[model samples]
Target: MTTRQNSSADQESAAVVILGAGPAGLTLGNLLHAHGIDCVVLERSDRAALGARARAGFLAANTVRTLERHGLADGLRRHGRPHGVCEFRTDGGRFRLDYGSLGRRELHTVYPQQDLVADLLTHYLDAGGRISFGTEALAVHDADGVRPVVAARDAHGRPARWQARYVAGCDGRHGAARRSLPPTALRHQCDHGVSWLGLLAEAPPSLDAVGYATHRSGFAGHMARTPEVTRYYLQCERGTPADAWTDEQVWDRLDLRMRAADHGPLRRGRILRRTVVDLSSDVVEPLRHGSLLLAGDAASLISPSAAKGANLAVLEAELLAEALVGDLAHGDATALERYSRRCLAHIWRAQEFSRWMIRLLHAAPGTDGESFFHESLRRSRLDSLRTSRAHQDWFAENYVGV
Candidate 1:
C-alpha cells in the first residue's frame, strides 16, 4: 500500500469496498446490487476517463453469456461484432483458421473494452449502485481482521475512510491492493522479453479476418475495432517510447513486417494513440488474504497476446461476485474459501495459452543459432496448427473458452 491518509469525520461504510472501476469492479458492483448486497466502488479516474480508456476488445463467448445473464449486455448485444477467423502469415505462406467451427464452436464478440466498461457503468448507476468516482483508494487497513478500513482521498483532496466487511481489489497490478499483500504472499511472473507498440488508427480495418504476421524483422498484427477505426501492433525495442516513430514510419514498418507487398496494403490514417506493451504475465497466489480478496488484474496480469486480459477480468469478477454474494447475503463461506483455487485454475490455463501465443508470434531473444532454432520451432508449431485438425480444435477451444 502507499502512504495512508488518516481517517476523518467523513467516514464511509459498505458491506464490500471495491477498488478500481474497471470491468471487474463494475461487473461485481452490478451483480451485488441485483443480489441486494451493499457494495461501493472506489475509482481514481473520472467517469469520462473510464469511458475513453480503451483496452482489449475480444470478449470470449463465456464473458458475453455472463454479462447477458446478469442483465448487463444490452449495449454489447447491439453493437458487438462477431469474429472468429485469424490469418497467420509466416516465411513459407499464410493460413487462415475459421475457429468458429472448431472446438466448442464459440466465437469472440469484438467489443471495445471501453464500450463494455461504459455499458457496465451505465447499468450500475441506473440501478442505484453506489460508486465513488475520482476517489483514490490509498490502502486497506486491518484486512486481516474483521471489517477492513479502506483509506482514500476524494476529488476534493479530503481524507476519507470506508469501512467494509470485505474488500475486493479490481485495481491493476501496481495498485494498493497488491501493495497491501503481506511480504510472504506469493507472486509469480514471467517476462517474455518482448514488447509491442500498440496502435489505434482512425481508418477502416484492412482485412476482414484478424491478421498475425511473423516477419524476419518482428511481428505485426491487425484487428478491427470499429467500422471507422482499426487497431494495429508492431513489435519494437524493449524501452522504445510509443511516439518514437512518426506516423509514416510506423505505417512503413507495419507494411514491411506485415508483408503488404505480397498480400495487400493497409489503409493509412491518423494515429489516434500509441502504447508500449511489454509481453509478460503474473499471478498472485491464494487470492484471498483474510478479508481482502483480489480480482481481475490485481489477482493476475495476463499478456495481451491472446486478448485474454479483459475476458479473464470479467470471468474472475463473476466468480468473485458469486463468492461475495454467498458470504454476504447468506451464511455460506464455501465459495469464498474455494475462490483462489478455482480462479487460479482458469488463470493458469489462460497464461499457458498466452505463452504459446507469444512464442508463436515472436522469435526468441538470443544469438543467431538460438534465434534460428527458435524461429524454426515456431514455424513448426504454426505448421502443425495449420494442418492438424486436432491442434486447431485445441486452439479454438482455448482461444474462445476462457
Candidate 2:
C-alpha cells in the first residue's frame, strides 16, 4: 500500500527491487529502509498465506546478536524459548551438548517461523515499507547491470514491470530469481538420500529444550514453539506421502521413535499439519548475476540436521544489508562482491557439520554392518569431540559463528 513517485518516467523505479517477502526479503527490506533506501517487495502470497508456510524454529546465538545490533531483539527474546543444552540420544544413552559450555552464548532459542515473520512484517510495514502481495514475477531482464526489471502481476491480475538500481532474488529455490541466473556459472549441489516427515503437532514439547533422538528405527527430533506446541521431525522414505498416513498411524510411528525413557509420556493432540522433503545442500557461486543478487534459500541451502535454515537466512540478510548500505554510502563494490564469498565460508562449514551429525545418527537402510562398527564410529567421534580442545574450539566457533 506504500507508493513512491517516479518523476519524468513512465515506469516505477527504486534503489532496489526485492522479490519474495519471506524472512530474507523482509529482513533485507527492513535493513534497507532503516538506511533510507527505497525498495519494494513482491510476494505471491498475501500476509495470511505466509503464515501457512513451514517453520524453522532454531535461532543461533550470532543471529540473536545480529537482531540485537539492529535493535530488534526484545520481541524475539520475549517470545522465543531459550535453552542452554541440546540432548543427543542414541541406543546406548543420551548425551548433552551445553551451548554455554561449547560456545560463548548460554543457549540458542526456538521461535516459531510464523512469529518471526509476523515480527519482521510488523516492523517493515510500520516504517512505510511496501510488500506487494499476490504478485508473481514473470521474468527478469538485464542482470548484468544498468539495473534489472521485474515483470510481475498484481493481486487483481494486472501486468506490470518495475526497474531498480539492483534486484535481490529472495524468491526461494523455485522462484524466477534462481531460474533467471545462468546455470553454468554457478551450479553447486549436494544431495542426501534422507528425507524427513515434518509435523507440527498441538501437543506440548516433551522436553525443556531441543531433543535429538537417534534410534535403531530412524532419526527423530523435537523442537518447541511454546509450552503447548511442539514441532517434530521423523526420517522417512524419500517420497513418503502424508496422505498415506492416518493421524493414528503417524502418531504411533512418532511415539515409538521419538519418546525416551527420560521423557515421561508421548502426549498426542490435534495434528496441525505435515509434509515431506528431501535433505539437500546447494550454494550458487557469487550469488550475483548482473544486477540480480540472491539471498537466503535462493543462494544456498543447508540440511535441517544442521539447524541452520532460519539462522543462516537471517545472517545472510543482515550481511547483505550491511554490504549494500556500505557500498552505497562509500561508492565501493567490495561488500557486494564479497557477500557471497563471505556467506559461503560459513555455509560450507555448517554443511560439513550437518553431514557429520546425520552420519553419526542415521544408519543406512539394509546395511549389514556389525554392532561394533556403529559403536566404534559413535565413540570415536564423541571422544574426539570431548578430548581435542582444538577440535572443540572449532565447533564452538562454528556453532556461534564468532
Candidate 3:
C-alpha cells in the first residue's frame, strides 16, 4: 500500500468496494470472498469502538436461517437463546401470546447485537478478509460510470481513493454513500409524533417474556437483553431530554405504567445509558444508482417499533451478495438490476408491519375529539389481537418472519 499523498489522483482498485462493517457490509464481504471475488470493506470506526456499539439484539427467524446457510451462525447458535412469548398489560387486563407456535412456527434468537458484530468481525478477519478499520468514506464519485470511486480519509488524516467495479453503500443513513447520491434520487420521510426514553438497565429481567404495558399515563415496555442487562422504553414528550428524569423517577413511572403493584414489583438497578428516540421512518426509492448500491439503514431507516432494522439489513445483504455474485462470477447482469426491486418489496412489507406496531403501542397524544376516536380504534385493535386467533397468527408471522 502506498502512503504518499497524491491528492487522491492515485487509487487502488477492487471488483467491489464495500463501505461499512456492520451486518450488511460484513455479510456481503464474507459471501463475495467465499466465491473468490475481490473486495474490501472500509469502516470509519476502529475495531474496538465498532465492537462496543450496543444495538438491537432481536434476530428474526429468516435472519437466523440466512446466517446458518452461510456457515456464519457458529457463535449465534452456540450462545443465542430461543424466545417466543410476549406478555401484554393493559387497563382491560393482561394476556400472554405464545407467538412461536402460532404463525410460521418460528422464534427469534436472543443474541446481543454487539456480540453478534464481534462474531462476524472475527469470522471475516480469520478468513483473510480485507478491511480498513479506520477508513472514513467521504464521498463516492462517478457511480453512474463503469468504475465507481470512493474518496476517503484514513486514521492519519491522509487522503486516499478506492476505485471499484461496484460500491456497496451500507455505511448508514448519514454515511458518504447516502451523501453521494445524485439529485434525482428520492427520499421519503415520516415522523410519528412520538418519542421514547430508551434505557439500558444493569439489572436482571423482571419477567420471562417480552412485556408491553399500555397505561393511562404512558406506554412502557420491558425486554430481556441478557441475564444481567435489561432494555426498557418509556413514552415521553417529543422534546424531552434523555436526562430529564432521575433514576428513581424512571423506575416509579415504569412501575406505574407497567402496573407492577397489581402484578409484581420490577427488579431495579443502575441505569447504564439513556437515549431519546423520536419515532420516525424513511425510505429511499430505487436503492441502486448505477454501479453504486445501497443496503441496511442506507437504503431505508425503520423505527425500532418492530425490531426489524437489523433483520432487514441481513436480508438485504444476502440478496445483494447473490445479485453481485451472479453478475461478477457468472456473467449475468439481470439479477443486478433486479436486486433493488427484490429488496424494495421486503422493505415495504417490513415498513408496513413496523407502522402497525407503532400505532398499536402508542395512543393519541392529547384528549381531543380526534384523540378519542384514534384511541378507541387502538383499543379495538388490541382486543382483536387478544381474542382473535387469526389476528394473533398474523402478528406472530410478521413479528418473527420479516
Candidate 4:
C-alpha cells in the first residue's frame, strides 16, 4: 500500500484530482495515467473496503469496449461471463428473450463490480498511478477559477489540501462533489413510488437466464452472479428495513412471488446482504462547471431497472478523459465544450428505457381501479414484447445497449 502524504504543511498539486475510487473515478484515473497525465485518486474508504464493495455486475457492450480500449478489461475478459437471455413471468405465462440474437446482437458481460474495481486498482498501481485511499474529500473551492482546491481529511484525521488544474467528481450523489455545486446548477429529480429489497444469496442461480416475475404480491428478480452466488430483488413497501424479514421468510416470499411452486423450487442458501433501494431517478444538468466536472452518480442517478449506472459511468469517464487530454495536451477545448451535451443525450435515453422497464415489471399500487388500469397497460406492453418482433428488437436494443 502507498503511504498517504500529509498535506497540512503544504498544499499538494496535481494536473487533475479524482474523487472516489469506484468505476468512474478509477476508469478516469487509468485513462489519464495511460496518457501520462498527472492525477491522484482520493477515496474515502481504505483499500480493502473499496476492493470489497459489491455493486452492479452487468457490463454493457460499450463499457467492455471502453475498458478494452484502455487495456483495463483483461480481468473481466478472463473471468466474466457473457449473458444475453432474460425471462419474464407473469400470470399470463413465461417467455424468454434471447436478446443477443436481436438488434445489434450485443451481450452484457457479467463481472461482479468488486472484482472489476480490484482489477482497475491493481492496473493503476502497477503503472505507477497515485491514489490516496482513506482520504475523504470535504469540499471543492474556487472551482470557477483556473485552479481548484480540494479540502480533505486523511485517514489519520489530518486536514489536507490539494490544488488541481481540474477536478473530476465521481464520488456519487451525496459526495462532496455534489455538495460543492453552486446554486446555479440545475437538478432534475423523479420518484417512481416503488422500492426494491435487493438480496444477495449464497445459492446458485435457479434459472439459466435473468428472471423477472410479476405477481399480485409484487415483483421478483433473479440474476446470477457466479456459480455459487445469485442476486435477487423483491418489491417491498417504501422505507422497509433491510432486515425486516428473516432469511426463511425472504426465501418463502421470493418463492411465492416468483411462482417457484408452478415452476421449481429455488436453490436456497444463506442471505449474504440485503438493502432497500428506492426507485428514483435524478440528473444534474451541465455536468461541467468551470474547473470541476461531474461523472457517474454525481452527474445522474438512474434506477437499476435497466442496469445502466455503471455503464454510463464508464462512458462518461472515457469522454471526460479524452476531453481532458485534448485540452491539456493539445490545447484543444472543443470536446470539453461539448461534453455535457453529448453525455446528457445518452443519459436521457437510458433514463427513459429504465422508466419503461420499471413500469413493465411492477404494478402500480393504489385502489383496485388504479391497479387494474396499470396492470392492463403492463400486460399490453408485455404482450407486445412477447408477440411483436419489432418490440422485442427494441427491448433487446435498449436492454444491452446503453
> Each model's TM-score?
0.97, 0.91, 0.97, 0.97
Candidate 1's TM-score reads: 0.97
- Ordered list by TM-score, greatest first: 4, 1, 3, 2
Clashing pairs in 1: 1-179
Computed on alpha carbons, the lDDT of every model, listed in order, comes to 0.91, 0.77, 0.91, 0.93
lDDT of 4 by residue, 1-402 (tens): 112334456588788999999999999999998888889999999989987787798999999998998899999999999999999989998999999999889999999999999999999999999999899999999999987999999989999899888999999999999999999999999999999999999999999999999999999999988889999999999989999999999999999988998999999999999989999999999999999999999999999998999999999999999999998877889999999999999999999999999999998787698788988888999999999999999999999988
Relative to the unseen true structure, what is the Cα RMSD of model 1? 3.1
Q: Write the per-residue lDDT of candidate 2 for residues 1-402, one digit (tens) a residue.
A: 122446234367677888988888988999988888888888989999897675887778888888888866767888887766667666656666665576454467777777787788888999999778898987788877676788888788888788887888898888888878875557689888788888889998877756777777788878887788888888888778965788887777777776544555677887798878688888888787777888888888778876777787888898888888877656778888888888888777777887877776676556556756865777677667656776666565565552
Which of the predicted structures, 2 or 4, would earn the higher lDDT when compared with the native?
4
- For model 4 the local lDDT of residue 21 reads 92
lDDT of 1 by residue, 1-402 (tens): 111222346887888889999999999999988998888899999999999998888899999999999999999899999999999988888899999999999999999999999999999999999888989999999899987998999999998889888999999998889988987789999999999999999999998889999988899999989889899999998999998999999999988887899988899999999999998899999899999999999999999999998998989999998998898778789999999999999999999999999999997776799788987888899999999999999999999988
Off by over 4 Å in 3: 1-10
Worst lDDT window (10 residues) for model 3?
Answer: 1-10
- Which residue pairs come into collision in candidate 4? none
Q: Best by lDDT, which number?
A: 4
Off by over 4 Å in 4: 1-8
Between candidates 3 and 4, the one scoring higher on TM-score is 4
Clashing pairs in 3: none
Off by over 4 Å in 1: 1-8
lDDT of 3 by residue, 163-186 (tens): 888999999889999999999999
